[model samples]
Target chain A: MNKKRIAIDMDDVMTDAIGRFIELYQQEFQEDLSDLRLPGRNLTNTVPPERLEAIKQYPHQPNFFKDLEPIAGSLEVVEQLHQRYEIFITTAALEFEHSFTPKYNWLKKHLPFITWKNIVFCGDKSIIRADYLLDDLDRNLKTFTGTGLLFTAPHNAHVTGYTRLNNWQEVAAYFLH
Target chain B: MNKKRIAIDMDDVMTDAIGRFIELYQQEFQEDLSDLRLPGRNLTNTVPPERLEAIKQYPHQPNFFKDLEPIAGSLEVVEQLHQRYEIFITTAALEFEHSFTPKYNWLKKHLPFITWKNIVFCGDKSIIRADYLLDDLDRNLKTFTGTGLLFTAPHNAHVTGYTRLNNWQEVAAYFLH
Candidate 1:
């Protein structure tokens, strides 16, 4: 039997993208984000209106995606999942043209087991064909043909109705078990 | 009504990849390829076995894919098809790691209408979701779930199972008419 394919989103699903954005915000404004409240369904909404424009520009910076810390337990869980299913690290990299090389290199450095052949850099997730998609964005999930397993993230906290995986451990239990 | 999506291959379908390789081979080896016999199925088989390794390394060189001339009439035909169908310029770029930027840049420069969102840089075409896939490689077509429209090239001249389109004009007639 053919292995079931799972299309994995890179940003908030695998990498802690909002966490990186928060770090970039703190460094740029010289302010701690700990005091701020986490806004539901949109991380940028938590920041001051004036700073939102600047924070959005972070992805355009060189190496912005290069050093992103993977979500807690993602590496180990994804590594195990790789053996059981076809995992494609699909990301919406077109919006930030500069992120292409850095994101590709980051995957090469971090997930050395996932070969270049399985890494996909595209904009729309609707074109992806897989048995399942683990993504944080509800919009992406809404468009996908496969079963959408909403990976829990602050920006996607408001999303409901789809199966949610709070963390990589949950992801493991959902699939591996 | 939703427009039918067409996942188009980039190398031989949109760009003249083999033609560019032949040009590079002539320039590097200081030998004209005009006298060489055209092999039925594989373009590389036409070249001397001793030069195949060096010829394969051409894509690894910077800007090898950037300056490739688009296949004859592809620009006009695809542009017309774009208005009718959801066209995605999908290329197998993972094999050529350095090609990510160049291929993206090439599309921006040439097919500016096909935005970055519609462009996909992937390895296996089997993961693509579309109503129709127009590709030059028989292998890519064989794996695609949708209707595979074989785009004719010297390398695929011998392949005969699927519908063959000889040129861009033929592609236009097939889709538009």
Candidate 2:
């Protein structure tokens, strides 16, 4: 039997991109973002209007995604999942052009088990073909033909309807257990 | 009604990568390759064995894919196809990691009509989802779930089984007409 294939999103699902954004915001404006979580929205509201452009340029910077820490339990759970399933690191890397090399390097450094052959850097997630897609964006999941597993992020706390995996441990429980 | 999607390959189907290889070979060794068409095989057979390493490095060069001219009539035919079909430029770009930026820039420069959202930089074509895939490699087509249209490239001249599109005009005839 063919092993089930899973297309995994990178940004917030695999790595803490928002956490990095929060870190950048704190370093730039010296503001504590303790109460920044807003349901059904991203941290954009927390960012000052005057500094919005600077926040936008963060992803465009070289090595922006290089040193990002993977989401809690993601590295271990995803590595275990790789043993049983054909997992692809399907990231919408085209949105930030400079993220291509850095993201590829980050994967190589952190998730060494994933071969370059299984890494896809694309724009739209709709063209992906897999048994399941684990993404933070409902927009991506809505267009997918396969089963969509909503990977919870602060921005999508209010979003519902799909099977939600709140964390990498939940992902492991849903798939492995 | 949802429009049928067609995933198109880049290297040989849309641009003449092998032709560029031939030009580079002639310039490097100063040998006229006028009779180099080996029919079933690629121009690699024509290159001296000692120079094979150099030939392999061509794709790794920073601007290798930047200035590659599109195949005759490809620009026109693909642009026309975009009007009716949800077209995506799906390329195995990870094989040459340096090719990401150049390939993306190349598409942006020549195929401005095709948005960045429609472009995909991937390694394996098997992960692609669409109604049809137009590619030169039989391996890619074999693994694809969609109908495969074998775009005639010199290396794949002997390859048969899928519907063959010898040129852009043939592609237009197959799809548009």
Candidate 3:
């Protein structure tokens, strides 16, 4: 039987990217950035409008995209969902040249069941065709024609529209049921 | 500049699948199959009709898709072309699950630069949006809205409508020029 494809984004969705960024900022300034807030409160939106370039440079960091920890229960839920549907890790990476292998290696290590063929490294998510997309950024989901689930993130907490998923277990229950 | 993507088929375009199939058929019946002509011939249209079921079993055989040798000069030309265009290995593999990893490993070994993200193992080519597609069958290219170059194969040799490429040299010259 042909299975419906569920495309999942990497940053802030599967990977605990916000946690890492907050931790990184805390280490640099020696201050608590966990309470840091954004003006628009979108994960994709940078604070003060000046740190956008700096935020883009994080992927270029040695292990920024590589060493990110997966959200709690994400790996287990992914494995469970993999048995029932075709799960694709559809991520946008055209902006980062050095992020290719690091992200590839991270998926290989963390989500070994997802074959390299199922992983898509794309620039624009608009060209991608899938049944559902789990992402934190509204930009990708806004343009996506499929069912876009706004996976919960720090900044996206204030944003609305489309279904919201607080965690991986919720995603599993939604798709599996 | 966003370069045009050139999607190439895996079976006959990259690997010598036609040569292997003809050789396998010749060895099985201990007779000449090379003299067999094709205009209405397809990858599934095995002569005598009795071999049709057996032809479908080829993908299940271990190393069937893995062990095929690369076409002469295909690799070198691909290397040269990789510098000029965004090359993707667009292959149809839903009919054969065992073929996925083998094809992936083959490309990794043979064409390391073409990352897993660029390689697409798809069933239907209709949704694929590439600037150009180099394929062995008319069914794939016929649905493609982009320019299609039918790479020469025993099954597709007699078919017409799209542009035909006899070898990798022609492909490089067409795209590189």
Candidate 4:
């Protein structure tokens, strides 16, 4: 039998891209643009489009990916789960073609254990089919027909009525056991 | 001049109480008690009151806190900021005495570097005062008069118009820099 497939969200589920964007935006603009949303609601909108577009064009920030801290125990969990499941990253940053490349590179660099073939970047996650989907967004989770594990993100704490895992350790334990 | 004080939330901010409770309840009851809140409201009502009451009395799950993973970079950032500011944990789990003790003990044991005197456990955060408050709830943020750094929680992603930080590294850089 084929191993079950698991799709994971990127922004908050794996990397701290949203966190870094806000830091850089605040430094350059002297304004906190954390509340703004991207064209789609899946990703964090910490910088305005005009500024974000510009920032994207600039050479990737120094140690941009290396600085990104994975959600606690994410690396270990992914490593363990890889033994039983085919892991793929389904993110919503499709519009920014090259924007997520650095992030992908960072993920590859940091989580050398995860194969590059498993990474899938797209704006709409509903298109993907998997046995399990781990995401922080209710919309994404609702769209997925699989066993959805809602990663308890700070923003989504208000959301109720779902299987919520606050840390990667719980997620790992949930799947492994 | 007194340095600006930092107010941090406890339940999801520092401790994985919600996650722990769910995991333990599921193991004991053999039922998936995932959602904690009611369908439409932020209040926890998904788990029936009778079940919640019973679940609450179960022996404190020591491994729950022991196995918890901190929010990415939260400890390092908190420690770094402790050098310049009065890092105060102004959490709101004090209404239930039973719940508060374990959460407090978990944080105290995991993060011993934080001063015991600086920790403030209360039922409502609106009653507290601070220079800057890092919280995951929009309601709590709205109540505070100071600059509220809405921690970019997964659910709160839908809510807009606030300074948000997705992880502790960005938070530390935001305040320290």
Each model's DockQ score: 0.84, 0.83, 0.10, 0.01
- Predictions ranked by lDDT, top down? 2, 1, 3, 4
Q: Output the TM-score of candidate 3.
A: 0.57
Off by over 4 Å in 2: A34-41, B34-38
Clashing pairs in 2: none
TM-score of chain B of each: 0.94, 0.94, 0.87, 0.74
lDDT of 3 by residue, B12-71 (tens): 788976666667777787766554445445646545677867765766766678767998
> Each model's TM-score, in the order given?
0.95, 0.95, 0.57, 0.41
Query: What's the C-alpha lDDT at position B20 in model 4?
Result: 68
lDDT of 2 by residue, B1-177 (tens): 988999999998888787777777788778766445456765567667887788879888777787888899999999999899999999998888888888888898889988878888888889999999999999999999989999987778888799998899999999998
- Best model per lDDT: 2
Evaluated at residue A117, the lDDT of candidate 4 is 43
Candidate 1 backbone overlaps, count: 0
Every candidate's lDDT:
0.84, 0.87, 0.74, 0.65
The true-versus-predicted C-alpha distance at residue B144 of model 4, in Å, is 0.8
Model 4 whole-model lDDT (C-alpha atoms): 0.65
> How would you encode candidate 3's per-residue C-alpha lDDT over A31-126 as one tens digit per residue?
555554443353245444665566546666766776788888888898898999878887765345455556677888999888765776655565
Better of 1 and 2 by DockQ: 1
Q: Model 2, residue B104: displacement in angstroms?
A: 0.4
